[model samples]
Target: MVGVMDDNRLYAIGEVARRTGLSVSAIRFYSDEGVVPPVEVTAGGHRLYDVHAIARLEFVSTLRELDAGLEDIRRLLAGGLTLTELATAHLSRLDDQVRRIRSRQAVLRTIARQHTEAEQVVLLHKLAGMSDEDRDRLMDDFWSEISEGLQVSPDFLGLMRNGPLVLPDEPSAEQLEAWIELADLLRNADFRREVREALRETFSGPGAAMMTSSKMVAAFERGGVIMGRAQEAQRAGTPADSPLGREIADAYTAYLGEIAETPDSPAFREKLAADVLDIERLHLESLEEYKTSTDPYTRYQSLVAIIDGSARQAAEFMPFAWLSAALKASVSP
Candidate 1:
């Protein structure tokens, strides 16, 4: 035990070691490094620490174990590291390190389970670098590029313009597989041509453009109204065939027919029909291509299947169908 003098100065190095759980040599080394200078020396020439020095020494040991450099620890002990700025910088660095470690861990787990090759490591790294938004943007650009020059309706274009991919933060193996497959498919020229052709079909007829736009709007609005009414009807126990219900239904059907027709012109109509057939064939070809391609990554197959099912259903049941019926009812004897 280093002696404690009567003036209340902290005793020699041994006392600091017992209190800080650091070795006496470590305390002396830090002092020599100017990390935590000793407060004073005794008559026998033993180094002594004040209460403040002892506390600072303990802080040095803690910081060092956390991978802080000795220089940084020295700055901290010397009161040069302003709490706000220095801490903020360190915290950011720590967060980045943590994320990198986690990403590596995830890749290692994949390799262990799947026995993947070197190429898989590169792929995993690429994926780790991609944010959800970035991934979606890549897919959107791919679809838009391939689908260009096809006369798709504004509604379909709008749908495409909105992100088509839906990868979650913690994506599943299936989802990751789907993303890779989708990316590969987007690069295929034949696939692109097919998608373009199919999309052109809806824009082939006279007034096709006008019809598509109007139908899209009418369908969306009518659907919302129908849902509200359906809820009300369900609550009131009223049959959906009531006068109010029929009016809503009829209006919806009529709108559909209005968009599907153009001002009469037999020659133009014939040309339009031909264009439509070509577009349909092209689009169908793309789908056929998908069928023949190596089974898409599971993620992509699931994503496309879900998106396609919902989209096709919406197109078929668009409220414009009801509008068409209303227009027909008004004209009949």
Candidate 2:
């Protein structure tokens, strides 16, 4: 409590409250907490504040509003911590709080939408609680296992072995779901073995294993141009049997020749067309298995891309879809 005061520089607690717009009790609590002690005390035991003390009260109010614990504030006032350190600590705390809240929201939405089983509900909560470092480490280990001892271009492997997945601070339900799916995929031996075997077969061509990294990159870039044309033709609804389609097919045949170290001839074209159909059949089989839905791997990468704001270039197998059509047309009657 504070009564009338006569000093021009010193103010009663009431005036300090009026000047700072803080409640009388709040200032008292701050004083009692030793965060902002009054400059003087009256004979009647009232607290008195000079301008400097009032300024400190205002600063204390701001810190309290930011959820700074009293001990931290006291240490800050005692010169044990700098303002920059305090702000940085609080900022990191806020980031963690926001992440947790957003994770809870995502978990709730996923559970409600999916009617997730108790077993999975437990797992989802565990995943939501994981720090970014733990999540990244888990992803790193999975990719390491997938690419281990593979006879493929390191550059090619690097593309699929995407770097850290930085889930946005405020993750969406979809992103969480994708993360969970990725975690599950990593745990599934069948998925791991299949992905490895596919990579093995794709890179097992006679000349593919023999090409230097630079040659592999050069071949990949040249193929990119052909796939770009394939995408354009596909987008324009060009008939597969059109001359334009055959031209694109011929270009792809040459690109394959470069990779296979085989000369472009009808025999090679026939072999290429047969090889293309084999891949096309595999894709068709996948579509049948999933009823034309996005494959789990593709869906996971796409969702992760949205979260991290990084582009996940469409998988190589995807562009090859258009090329498969052209190859079929080139070989048909």
Predicted structure with the largest TM-score when compared to the true one: 2
The sequence of per-residue lDDT tens digits that candidate 1 reaches over residues 68-154 is 778766666567886565667777778777666655665666667668788767876666556767767777776667567756565
Q: After superposition on all CA atoms, how large is the RMSD of candidate 1? A: 12.0
- Cα misplacement distance, residue 170 of candidate 2 (Å): 7.3
lDDT of 2 by residue, 66-144 (tens): 9987887888999999988998998899988877787787778778878888888888788767778988887777778
Which pairs clash in model 2?
none
Residue 287, model 2, lDDT: 44
What residue runs in model 2 are displaced by over 4 Å at the alpha carbon?
1-9, 131-158, 163-177, 188-218, 221-292, 311-333
lDDT for each candidate structure: 0.59, 0.74
Candidate 2 matches the true fold with a TM-score of: 0.57
